[model samples]
Target: MESRNPVIRRYADFQKPGSVLGNNQGRYDGNVITSTPVDETTQTFPGRTPAKPGERVVTMDDVVMKSFAMLALLLVGAFVGWNAPGLAIIAAIAGLVLGLVNTFKKNVSPVLVVAYALLQGVFVGGISYIYQNLVVADGTNIVGNTIMCTMVAFGTMLFLFKSGIIKVDAKFTRMMMVAMVSYLVIAVISIIASFMGVGGGWGFYGVGGIGILLALFGVGLASFSLMLDFQSIRQAISMGLPEKESWRLAFGLTVTLVWLYLEMLRLFAILAGRRE
Candidate 1:
């Protein structure tokens, strides 16, 4: 299945046919199916010892635990960033660079992923502070509201996806890709406009009804991106990927959740700004 997630799509190990993952099915790009049938009796994968009796494989529990671990690290970083708000821009830039590295790295490094979580947390925390203190109206509780919204969105999407209410097929993937690309272009332009003092320094996202619409669109995009992450993790588990691959899956989920949170934060901030 084609995935728009940069983290999932960049995994070359999953695509390898006769490689460590065994003679599995086709890769993520939907090409190069291995002719050799998988041996049911024997299980072996790279980056770890051979599957022993009662040895663990990649499971939902593993992914969830790793995700929580990363989230903990992120929260710690966020605390530091919240205390020292001046590190916001620097953390954002560093987080972006680390994110790109983690995304493109052939082998998953738990250390690097953990580092990313912390740095990303700092960026997120700094931004949240700015929105709550300087951007939103007094007593708006923008951060609290945004966090609640993000959690709700995540739960809603997971329920919809697992209950078959949402199906991530090729058609759906294509549509999402198009929408994501278009949104990215619009976001870039809006940022530039904001820098140039347009839309009262809020860019296209502050132009009355249009700005509200754009913020809603952003929230929607981030929300739907969760579905993609869910689908990818489900596929990875079904494929019997290595246990270590859980880090990569967790990283992808963290990335999506962070994006969603940021989107919600911005939406709340924009609405609060309008009210003020």
Candidate 2:
């Protein structure tokens, strides 16, 4: 009966106090699936092993699934607030505060995490509503385009991480943050100039010839954010962290991915608007 409980089921290693499972030290035997652990195998005692070397024996799926579940709750929350108008704004503020709280906390709390997700949904859905109603795209394809671009950017990032194409280093993260801040500063200045009826250079809004430059810069920001997410995943895997962490991973990814998509959307909009 205890085995059926979600929390207890994950404590299998804990249940066995003196064995390798309890001590947290794996004893690799020659056979991969046998009751012993080998250099490249994880024992699935009393039956199977990881099966192959260099294979991902541990995945972030647990985190991803839980994260999506939070997101699902968020979307429902968004729908409720969307039809109600003022509620979304309230939710947005609450979401922002929760986001900061979650980011600073070392341990993940399902309640806060889920609450944050729902709050963030309001912000996203609100923006989607504005874009659909105000912007002109290929009819019903704007939302689809946004979603597609987001998924593609995310998938590309995941592929790069898996293929050893992008190495995550402390220096890399610092440089990326510097560049991102610079971009944000420039964007703010451009808006200020526009308000004054003065035109600045093309660096901020993809105006002049700097639009592509800004686009690449946005991509770099998203990529570095991915690196940080990967770092967290690595730590969780090594520490035998809880399976619920998968939700946190997904939340982090969704944040970065959504930011990347918006940047790309703006870049495209700038280019398309110019062409028109």
Candidate 3:
């Protein structure tokens, strides 16, 4: 089955591969869902046949390149955030809005996607600086370790998917969806608890053993979420989606990566806090 990810699921093309024309949002004139042959009236981009015109199909390379661009922008934003960690809250709110817009928007806007990356990067960098400078007492290089852990998780998941060790079938998707929802509810409760001065203001996650367990769970969930991202990319390319959709896929992947990194960072911080 296709991923339950809102960003990936919005595309009708993913539901019925090659059913829609290779236009923005995979729709034709007036958002019609027709399967009729591409008549001369259909528009093209630059490399397609005369029948379908020159519209280019989505490719792995397109996703890779767009992902790189998004990451670069994020790094730039992270640099700024590292210098001024105070921007974390403002950037986080702004980034959440942009992320939601980019995820559900009908037409993929590369500009907005990259903007989200930059804003989220600020949040990430801000939190990372706090962890490195204020949290760790032993100079454990927690931030660097978190980055390495995130990368390892990514590579491990990719290997599992490629080696056929883990498959994104309907059952797996359903289970992940359920787990995500449950974890979200718990996270909300934990936040409320934290605000109420529970567990030293860390919520359920700051309650020693329970907090560490929850943090580990979060890291695991985020790691597995990467599989769904990978599956979405594969499906998009196989469905022959429009090249512009690459921006959407890249955005989805970036979102997962950011989530994974954040989870890892939190986990490391918790362990370091315990040590302190």
Candidate 4:
């Protein structure tokens, strides 16, 4: 998946031409990097040594930049859509288009990603607004609360990583991967059941234990996904990836955040329904 901070960084540095030395200038070896040769034969380094080895220079600049940009765009779209579901539908369609464009394009485009964010925002906000109108009064605030909770969880994970409270080793990754895939399978089955008119196996909002469990499960998967994303981004930086792929990294992060928020929203709805 194309996510926030990928484990692999694109090395734009590799695009730089290699060093070439001329035969006549072979003896002119100095501190300068001019194309001068040191001997009668020309010396050229088509392929060189390992790139930027042992560099642990991971910066949060890329994450902050892309995330903020996407958030801002999304807010605007969401606000508009919240007021009008029609607009939300359009935004959703546009978002789908932009998402495809971003994923399939050979080159990454920040504009497209930002556009996609806006569209998704509209759809989310509009849906929240509709939920408020359809459910009990002031139901829309539920979405707000869900958003806050999701943010808190995301920040918690980040802080844990930064503070070294979490161990992100291969074994841990393997466990998480297995859990995530299994969770996805369960989700797919639940969706199919729902389509077949099977109510969460629970009466009313309870939709049964399956519904409630899936809601909570989504939250956990999304939160764990964030850990994976941050780790990937950091490794990419150490590997010295190009800056242009910031959009790719940003796209990944956006996906996780969205998934996390949606899960929070669903979990909240479940809790709210139980109270009623």
Candidate 5:
């Protein structure tokens, strides 16, 4: 009933006195209380025993399963797109639109979340193929290297978060948001410059040492974003969000991972370009 919980504060409507959400299992009447306790009695009749009712709150297994489902769909889409890189552009556009829709929508939609994952897979696979062709002429397997680095970074962040080494307090969250906004602005400027034929072929991204610096900054931001996502999942579980919201959590993690992967890819590409 405390508003101090971030997840509860965000979803206050779901925690209304009469609402069936959170741990509010019953209401007090003038002379008695109403409750809906689960019936756990096992019957030995011909009919199968009724299954036990599951907890209403989110769980670790729920989050894990949802994430796995999304990842599987993404891999399938990636395979299709990798073989046909021509669909990358369309997939990228569609992914961007779906990402925005999912982020702004009031309620989570499993279909939209899955669609976004699929589109992102296509975009990622296409880009990976292109990047590999560009820098892996000697068969260096840059894509594999990038994936390894991304997973390592993800695991390191998760460990730090679980160990309480990296707390996601208000100050940390604010700082990361400001940093992300600044990075986005710089990226937009670089993109515009590139379209106008500025800074040779790399635009503002290649100005002096900006490319590598920005790439490093982006990677750091993406890693921090992972921490934020993990904290959010913890908060949701603590506040007893509905199990269905697990899909939303999964989508958030997927988005952060994709961003991290792209940043890693860019960093590796910049380093390879410098070597050449």
Candidate 6:
């Protein structure tokens, strides 16, 4: 399986022949007809009707449910963090560490994934509160606008992916990877320059015509990342991954969505700042 998404690539390592769709053997009784014993083959498992064999394989519904559960926990954490923005720095650090741990570990731990989601929610909520305070006073609901835009982008990407309009091929995946690396390099440089007091307000990000462009690029990147995620989930389902892997899928999606939301928030902040 060719996938640019790191989570999918990692999970794909676990797949084996017959691991996805196991072979079915008919039930045999002691009765013999001629030289061979009589065997009963049924479409459903014993005591279960209408449900085909291997029906318990992973499904989109499982991924969606797991994703929703994680989101719900994140919302709860966000509510708590929004009321206490001072903890944003700590939450951000913790979230980053947890994210790295979850990403590198071979076996998925539901507890750790949930913990990471909660920490991310805290970081998001705290930063959102800060951004709202800074930009909302200008009579613009930056946070609300960002949320709406993120949802719109997500829906658009999902539609495009599911409709087969945006195919995930090796070439496309390579291009996306290159673009992401370039963007990350720029971001790192900007952060360093900001710390050194170079380029003032937005550092390299705020240079003439750069700030808005970077923001647009970031939004686009995050949206495309979501598409990669969709492809990963679709592939996982088609390959009949175990249901337990749903947590990994959910974690990956949550991470991308949070990235999208943050980028949207930053874009709006820049615009609001310019307006003021």
Give the higher-TM-score candidate: 5 or 6: 6
Q: Residue pairs in steric clash, candidate 6?
A: none
Off by over 4 Å in 3: 1-5, 8-53
Q: Estimate TM-scores for all models.
A: 0.84, 0.66, 0.84, 0.73, 0.79, 0.81
Q: Candidate 5: misplaced stretches above 4 Å?
A: 1-55, 135-138
lDDT of 5 at 180: 71
Sort every candidate by lDDT, greatest first.
3, 1, 6, 5, 4, 2
Q: Pick the lDDT winner.
A: 3
Candidate 4 at residue 101, lDDT?
71
Q: What is the C-alpha lDDT of each candidate?
A: 0.75, 0.55, 0.76, 0.62, 0.71, 0.72
Candidate 6 per-residue lDDT over residues 107-181, each given as its tens digit:
679999999989989999999999899544687899889889988999999999989998876566667667777
- Give the runs in model 6 whose Cα sits over 4 Å from its true position: 1-5, 8-56, 135-137
Write one digit per residue (lDDT tens) for candidate 3, span 96-145: 89988886687778889989989999999998999899877878889999
Candidate with better TM-score, 1 vs 4: 1
lDDT of 3 at 276: 77
Misplaced by over 4 Å in model 4 are 1-59, 136-140, 200-206
Q: For all the candidates, what are their Cα RMSDs to the real structure?
A: 5.9, 10.6, 6.7, 9.4, 9.6, 8.4
RMSD of 3: 6.7
How far residue 181's Cα lies from its native spot in candidate 3, in Å, is 0.2
- Across 39-96, the per-residue lDDT of candidate 2 in tens digits comes to 2222122112222432333345666677578658766765765565456577778877
lDDT of 1 by residue, 1-276 (tens): 323355435332333444434454322222222234454423223343322333345778889999999999999988888888889899989888888887767678899999999998998888889889888756799999998999899999999999999887656666777788899889889999999988989899888899889989889988988887787677666555556778988998999888889888888888888777
